[model samples]
Target: MEFGTTSRTSGKPGPRRERSPGGSDYAVLSRQVQEAGLLRRRPVRGVVLLVVTAAMLAGSWWLFVAVGDSWWQLAVALPMAFAFTQCGFRGHEAGHRQTFHSKRLNNAAGLVFGNLFVGLGFGWWMNKHNRHHAHPNQVGRDPDIESGALVFDGDDAPGRTGAGAFVTRHQAGLFFPMLLLEGWNLHVASVRALRSRHTGAPAPAAVEALLLLVHAAAYFGALALVLSPLKALVFVLVQQGLFGLYLGASFAPNHKGMEMLSRDERLDFLRSQVLTSRNVRGGPATDFLLGGLNHQIEHHLFPSMPTSALPRAKPLVRAHCGDLGLPYTETGLIDSYRQALGHLHAAGAPLRAGG
Candidate 1:
C-alpha cells in the first residue's frame, strides 16, 4: 500500500475527488485510526500535567502575593498568566475527552479547570470549539473566523461606516493589541452564555456562573489584600492582557491565512482539516508552548487523540496528505504570524478602499 492511498480500506488508489460537507472521508480516516489504536486515553499523563500546572499556578500566585513592590508583583504575575494558559489547554483537552476515558471524569475535570479555575465556561467553549473543528475557516459556519473587527473572508468585510470602517481599515495593525482584550471578552462571553436560556442545562450553567463568581471574588480579594488598589488594577490588566495575547497568538496560526471555504462549499474531512490548518516548525519548546497545537491538522482530524500523541501522528498524517496531493503547510511560528497578518491586511483592503 502507498503512503496516502486509501487502498487499505477501500482498495482504491486514494480518496475520491468529490467533496463532502459531511466529511465522508472522515469515516475512512476514523477506521484507520481505530485499527491503529490511537484513540486510547493516557490517564497517567493527563493527571501528571494537571498536577504540574496546578503547582505552577499556586507557585506563581504565591510569588505574586509575596512580592513587596508593585513592579515585582507584575513580574510574578507574568508566570501566573502562563500557568493559567496551560490550565486552559488542559481544560480544552478535557473538553475533547482526550484526557480521560470516562466522560464523567472528563466533564468534572473540565468544569474544575476551565470553569472554576480559569473562569471560562467549559460547556460554552466546547460548543463553540466543536463547531470550529467541524468546519474550520468556513466563512459563515466557523465562529472563530467571524470576527467583526477583523475581516477573514470577503463576506465578513464591513460596510463603510463608523467604528466598523475604522476597525476594518486598521485590523491588521491592531490584531495583537486587540488580542489584549480577548481574555476579558472570553469571560464576558462565558457569563453571557451562562445567563442565556438557550445554553442547555440550567443547573450546570448556574454552577458554572457561581464558579466564575467565586473565581472573581478570590482573585480580586487576594489582590486587594496584597497590593494597593491602583497596583491591583494594574496587576489585573497586565495579567489578563498577557493571558489573552498568549492564548490568541498561540491559536491564530492554526487556521488564519489558510484557505477559507464558503459555508456551502463541500470538502472531504482530510482536505478540510489539512488545507485550513498550518503546522508550526519547531522542537520541544514549541510543543510545550503550543500545548501540542503545533500539529493542528492531526488535532483537528482526531480531536480525541492525546496531546502527547500528536507529534507522533504528524509524520503519518503529513505523508498521507502528501500521497493524496493535499497541501501540508508547515512554517516557523514567526512566519506563520506574518502570513496571518498579511491575510488580514489583504482581506480588509476592500473596506479601506470603500472607506
Candidate 2:
C-alpha cells in the first residue's frame, strides 16, 4: 500500500515497481484539483490568445507582401513560421477541449485554427491525440511512439535496412534536421487522410477538406502574387521548415526518453500520466514558446484544464505525486531535449552494433 519507498531523486525513473491498480488515488486527487477550481475553463484568456495568434499570422503575411520581392523576405518568413506554429498550438488546445466550455465551440475553433489557418486536419489529429492521451508511450497504442522514420521502441529498431537503417542508426543526430520537413509531411498526411476517408464522408470531414483547400489557395496564392518565382519558393521553404522545427522542438521534450509501457503493462490514471510525462522548468517565455506544454505532467493529468491553469495545477500535482511516492520528472528545457535525444540514440544502438 505504501508508495514512494523507492528513490527518484535523480529525476530518472527507476525500475517499475509493483503498485495497486485502484483508481481511488486519482479520484481523490481529481476531487482536490476540482475543489481548487483549477479545472474550470478560462474562456477569456483562451480567446485573447486565439485572437493574438490570428493577428500575428495576419501581420506576418502583411509583412511578407510589404517587403516585396527581395531576399530579405526570408526574414518575414521567420515570424510567419512562429505564428503558424502558435496557431497549431491553439488548435491543439481546442482539440483537447481546453480552450472553450462548449465542445461545439472548441471543435469550431479547432477546425478554423487547424484546417483553415494551419492546414491540419482537426478530426484526424484529435483521433490520434486522444489515443496518445489514453495510452501514452505504450508499445502498441501511442501513435506518437509508433515505429516509422524514427523508432522509439527498441524492438522496432533492428530490422530496418537501407535508407531506413541509415536514418535509424543516426536518428539522434538527424532528429532536428528531419523536423524541417515535418510541416510538409503534415500537410501531405492531412490531405491523404481526407482523400482516403470512407464513402459518405461526414459533414465535419467535408468542412475540414474545404478549409484546407482554402488555406492552400490563400497561402500559395499570396506568396506567388507578391513574390518573384525564386523568392516565393524560398519563402515556402523557409516558413514551412521553421514552422515544423518550432513545433517539433516544443513537443519533443514532453514524453520522449520517459518510461514507456509495454502492451500489457498497466497503471492507474495518476501513475500512467504523471510517470510518463516530463515537465520542463521555465518562466513565462518558456510557457509562451512551448504553448504551456512545459507543464506536461499537469497537462496530461488534466487534459481539459485550461493552459493558463497548468502552472497553478503544477504544485498541487507535484505534491500529490510526492505524497504517493511517484516519480515526478522535471528538467531544464535544454536538458529535456538532451534526455529525449539520448533516448533516441540508445534505441538505435542495436542497429549501430549490427553495422
* Per-model CA lDDT versus the true structure: 0.81, 0.87
- Give each model a TM-score: 0.91, 0.94
Q: Write one digit per residue (lDDT tens) for candidate 2, span 127-228.
A: 778889999888899999999899998778889999999999999999999999999988988888876664432235678889999999999999888888
Q: Candidate 1, after superposition: displacement of residue 168 in Å?
A: 1.1
Candidate 2: TM-score? 0.94
- Candidate 1 lDDT trough over 10 residues, lowest sum: 6-15
Best by TM-score: 2
lDDT of 2 at 108: 88
Clashing pairs in 1: none
lDDT of 1 by residue, 1-355 (tens): 2245432111224433456457655676677677777778899999999899889888988888678546678887789889889989998899889988988889888888887788988888988898899999887899898866677865456554678778878888999999999999999889888766454432376688888899889888888888998888899999999999999999998988877776787777777788778999988899999988988988998999998888877777777677666668899999999989888887777787775
- For model 2, the superposed segments whose C-alpha errors exceed 4 Å read 1-17, 196-203
What candidate 1 gets wrong by more than 4 Å, as runs, is 1-17, 20-32, 158-160, 197-203
